[model samples]
Target: MGEQNPLCVNVSTTNSTTEILSRYDMINWVNDCLHTHYTKIEELCSGAAYCQFMNMMFPGCVNLRKVKVKANLEHEYIQNFKVLQASFKKVGVDKNIPVDQMIKGRFQDNFEFVQWFKKFFDANYVGQKYDPMEARESTIIWGGTPPGPSRIGHNNKVSASRLVHATKPTTRKASGLDSKHIGAATQTAGGAEGGGSQKLEDLTSQVSKLKTKVDGLEKERDFYYGKLRDIEVLCQEREQRNGKSVGTEKILEILYATKEGFAVPEDHVEEGAAV
Candidate 1:
C-alpha cells in the first residue's frame, strides 16, 4: 500500500520508477513505537499529514478491535503510516498485528516510537529508518539480505559492539530540553518487554493447539490403516474358500505337500459299480 493502493507487495524492480522500501530500516522504529506507546494506535504519535490520511481511511479504530500486521509492513512501509492505515481499513485487511510477530518486531525488550522519533530526527529521516505496525501483535524486522537496488548501509555498524548505531541529535539544539528524553523512552521499554512476554505465551498456546491437531491426524491414520489391513485379510480368506491364483494356489500346494505318494486317482478307481 505504499504510495497508493493496489501496491506491488514483494514485487522486484530496481528501476527508478519503483519506490522501494526496505524492511531492515524499520526495526528500530517499530520497537521504539511499541515501547513508547502502550496505548492503542488510535492515540499514536504526531505526523499531521499521515494523520490526515489515516483519519480518512480508518475513521473509527474503536470498533475495529483486532488486527494482523505482516513483517514486511512493519519493517518496510512503516514510515507511510497513512498507507498502512489505509491498507488495514481496506475491507479485506485486518487492523491488528498478531502476537506471534510482536516479539520479533522489536529491537530490544523495551523500545518505542519516541525512541524511534529520536533516532529518526537524529538520522535526519534517512531512508535507513522507516517502519509501520502491520498487525495487532506481530512485527517482523526484515532480516533478509538487501534486495537489488536496496540501500547498502542500513545494517552496517559503527563498532564491533554496536551491530548498528544511530547517534540522535541533541535536545539542546532541537527541542531546547536539558537532555535527551530517551530515558523516558527507556523507562517505557520495560512495559513493552512485559507485554512481549504475554504475547509469546499466546503463541505458545497456538503451537499447543497445532500439536493437538497433528496428534488427532496420526490417530486417524492408524485407524484407517487397521481397516485396510482387515480388508486385505478378508480378501485372502475368501480367495482360499473359492479358487484363485495366489490363494487357491497356496491351498493346492499345501494339499500336494500333505498327500501320500501315489494314491490311485479317485475317478479311475471305480467303486462297486451300480450295474
Candidate 2:
C-alpha cells in the first residue's frame, strides 16, 4: 500500500543486495522531486489560495497523514502510502490492499486530528469540512462567522458609540422641574406686567359695577328730596295768606281787661252806637 502512494518510489528486490541498493537510490531521487511539491500544498492549506495543483499530485499525497513526511532532506526520506491495488498490474512496484479500509480516515473531526499527531495536517480541508468558526473555538481564538465581500458579518451586532449617539433626551441633571407657582409676578408668567394687567382688569370691572349701583341709589334719593322741598314751599305760601294759619289765635286781646265782659270789642263798638 505504501508503494502505490507514489510519494515514495516503489522498490522491488532482485534477490541480490545490488537491487536493494537500487531501491534506496530510487527513494532518494523521489524525495527531491516531492520536496517543493509538499511545501506548495502546505501554503495552499494555510492560505486563502485554492489548491490549484491538486490535479498534478496524487490525491492526499502529503501522504494525507503527515507523520510520514513527504520530504525529509535529513535522511532523504518520503512517505509512500498505498492508494489502490489493481490486478491490472503496471510496470511500477506496489502492495495489494483493499480501497475501503485504507480510505476510512477523514480530514475532518478534530478529535481524529489530535489522535493523528501528524505534521503538515489538513487545514483548509479540516477547516472547511468542519466550520472554521467551530475550529477556532478549540483554541483561544474567538469563533465567529466569516466576513462577506464587505468584510462584515451579516446579523452581527456591534454598537459603535462613535458612529451613533445617545437616544435619551439631552437635558442636564442639574436642570430640575420648576414647580413654583408662577401667576402672580414672575418672568415665567410673561413678566409682572402680564399678571398685574389681568388683576387690574378684574378689579376695574367690580368698581364699575359698584359705581353703577351707587348712582341708581343717589337718583332715587334726589327724587324723594325734591318732592319734600315742594311740599314745604306750598305750606309756607298758605301760612303767609292767613294770620298765622287756619287755626291761628290772637294772644294779646284776650290778656287785656276789655275782654272781661261779653267782648270788649262789642262794648267799644256798641257804646259808639249805644242804640
Candidate 3:
C-alpha cells in the first residue's frame, strides 16, 4: 500500500486551541490572517504564509523577498523557515520553529505549532489593517527569479544583478584536488578512487536520511508529550475547581501511571479506552 497523505491525517489528540478549534477553523484562521487560499494545514510548511503573518503583526520585521512563496524542495523550505526564524528573533518572539518536522509536512506537528502561533497572534496583533498581498508583493520573488530592473527602488527593492550573484555558488579553488593532480591520480587508481567516492557518498546520504527520520520521531514524541501535559494541566484545573469525576480519574490514572512506574488497573484502562 502507498504511504498515507500527511494533509489527510485527522489528528485525534487533545486540541491545542483554547476554544477547541477544529481543523477547518484553524485553516480558516490561517487563510484569513494571511489572505491565502490554503485548504490543508500542510500547505503552511512552505513558511511563506508564516512570514507574511509576522509581517502583518510586526511591520518590516520579515523581508518577504527572502521567503520562498512556492517552495517545492526541502532546501527551499529551509530557506523560508530561516527567514521566519530570523524575523521571530528580531521581534523578540521567543518561539522555536520546528523546521525539520515542519518540512516533512506532518499534520499533527504542524497543526500544534500553528495553534500556538494563532494564540500568539491573538495576543500580539494590534488591530491593524495590514494588506498581506501588498506586503508580500512589495518584495516578493517569483518562481526563483529575481525582480526585474524596472522594479528596483531606494527602499526594499533588491537589484537583479545582486540577487543573481547572491544565488550563484562561488567557485572555491581546490588545494590538492586540482585538475592536473586529479588527472595523475585518475591514471594511477581511477576505479578504486571512484568506487570509494561513490561508497562515501552513499554512506553520507544514508546517514542524512537516518538523521532526518530520527528528528521527525523526536518531534512527534515531543508533540504528543506537550498535548498530554496540556491535558494534565486542564485536569488539574478542573479538579481544583469542580472536582474530578469518573472520566478525570481514569485519564489521570493513565497519565500518572506513565511517570510513576505503576500499572493502571485493567478496568480503568477499559473504561478510558471506551470513553
Candidate 4:
C-alpha cells in the first residue's frame, strides 16, 4: 500500500535493559527501510528479542498478540519462552495470558507464521481513532493557507475571477495626443494613417485576386456541367431512335406475312430480324 497504509510488524525481546523503540521510531524505520508508513500495527509476534522489544515500545498495548515461537535449540527455545513470559508480565499484557497458557510447550511451525498472524489480526484488529478538532488543527498547521491569485500591475491587485472577466485594454497612441493638439500631432498621425492606407490597399488587392480565382473556378465548373448535359441529350436521342427502329421492324414483319407466297429479299429479312 501507499506510505499512509502500511503493514506493521512488532518484534519484541526478553532483554529488559535494551533500549525500547517507540511507535514513531518504528514508523521512521519502516519508512526508511520499506518506504511505507507504520500507521497501525496489525500483528504482534513474541520471541526472546521480539517480546522484549515490543514490551518496551508498546508497554501496555492490549492489541499486541502472541505467535508460536520456533527454535532449533531446545534449551535456547525454553530460555526465549521464559524471557517472553517475563516481558509480557512487565508490559501488563494480561489479555494474552490465556493464549500463553494454551500454546505452552507447543511450538508453531515457521511455515504457518503468515496464516497464524492473519487469523490473529482478523480476530483482534482495531482501527486507530482520533479527535476531529485535533485532526483539523493538525491539518491547518501542516498545510498552511492556500496560495493567492497572481498579480499584474504594481498597483493593481486583481483576483483570478476578476482577471478572467476583465476586458483587454485598447491600443492607444504612444504620445496620447487629443483633438486640441491636432496641429502638433498632424505629422505623426499622417505617417500612421499613410501606413494604415497602404496595408488596406494590400488587403484589397489580395481580395480582388481571390475573387478572380473563384470566378475562374465557377466558369470551369459551368464548362464541365455543359459537356455532361450534351452527353445526356445524345444518350436520350439514341434511345428514341432505337425504339422507332423496333416499331419499323414489327411493321415489316406484318408486310412479309401478307406476301407469304412471294419470296422476300434476303437482305431485308436479315435487317428486320436483326432489328
Among the numbered candidates, top lDDT falls to 3
lDDT of 1 at 102: 30
- Collision count of model 1: 26
The worst-scoring run of ten residues by lDDT in candidate 1 lies at 160-169
Candidate 3's displacement at residue 25, Å, is: 0.8
Candidate 1 ranges beyond 4 A from true positions: 1-192, 245-275
Candidate 3 Cα outliers beyond 4 Å, as residue runs: 1-17, 138-275
**What is the clash tally of candidate 3?**
0
- Cα lDDT tens digits, model 3, 1-275, are 98433211122223443556776799778877666656555557778888888888788888887887867566778899999988876766657778888876655667888877777777677789887778777533221211112122233123222332322221122222244444544454445475777655665565556556654554454345434544554665577689778887787666554333544344422321231
Top candidate by TM-score: 3
Separately for all candidates shown, the number of backbone clashes (residues 3 or more apart, or on different chains) is: 26, 1, 0, 12
lDDT of 4 by residue, 1-275 (tens): 54342223333323352344543444344334223222211111223224323333444432223422223233444455565556545544332332332222221222133233233333333533323223222221110101122112223232222222221111122123233244433444455575776655665565556556654554454344333323333343454567545544454333223323543334422321231
The root-mean-square deviation over C-alpha atoms between each candidate and the true structure, in angstroms, is 31.0, 61.5, 21.6, 40.7
- Give each model's whole-structure lDDT: 0.32, 0.26, 0.59, 0.33
As a whole number from 0 to 100, the lDDT of residue 218 in candidate 2 is: 42
For residue 230, give model 3's deviation from the true position in Å.
27
Q: Rank the candidates by TM-score, best first.
A: 3, 2, 1, 4
